[model samples]
Target: MKVRVFVTPKKGVLDPQGVVIETGLRQLGFAGADQVRVGKVIDLVVHTDDRDDASARVHAMCKTFLTNPVIEDYTFTLDEAP
Candidate 1:
């Protein structure tokens, strides 16, 4: 199975990196871009044929190591390997 995870800072949390990127964009003549927030997308393959089991495992992974539950939020999707 394939799993895709998206991790991002929680709302109201100060994102210094995001701020820098936003500032850089405006300086480079990107006027329409605003409130740019940076996040991460992780893609990996898990050896499982059952969707439920794969989802459960991925959820566990997220809670245990993938996300910093206090200041970050995460979401994941599971699919059959292509």
Candidate 2:
């Protein structure tokens, strides 16, 4: 199975990278670009036939290593591999 993970900073947490990007956007004439947050997209291949099991394993992976639960939140989607 192919799994996609989206990790992002929690609300109210300070995002220095986001702040810098937003400031740069304003300086470059992108006034409408607001609340810019930089995050990561992780793509993984899990060897599994069961969607539920794959999701469970991916969740565990996120909780154990892929994310910082205190300051970052994550969500994932699963798709069958070709």
The lDDT, on a scale of 0 to 1, for candidate 2 is 0.94
Worst 10-residue lDDT window, candidate 2:
31-40
- Among all candidates shown, the one with the greatest lDDT: 2
Query: What RMSD does model 1 have?
Result: 0.9
Candidate 1 residue runs with Cα over 4 Å from true position: none
Cα displacement (angstroms), candidate 2, residue 25, comes to: 0.8
List the pairs of residues colliding in candidate 1: none
Worst 10 residues of 1 by lDDT: 73-82
* RMSD of each candidate relative to the true structure: 0.9, 0.9
Tens-digit per-residue lDDT, 1-82, candidate 1: 8899999999999999999999999999989998888889999998989998889898999999989999999998887857
What overall lDDT goes with each candidate model?
Answer: 0.91, 0.94
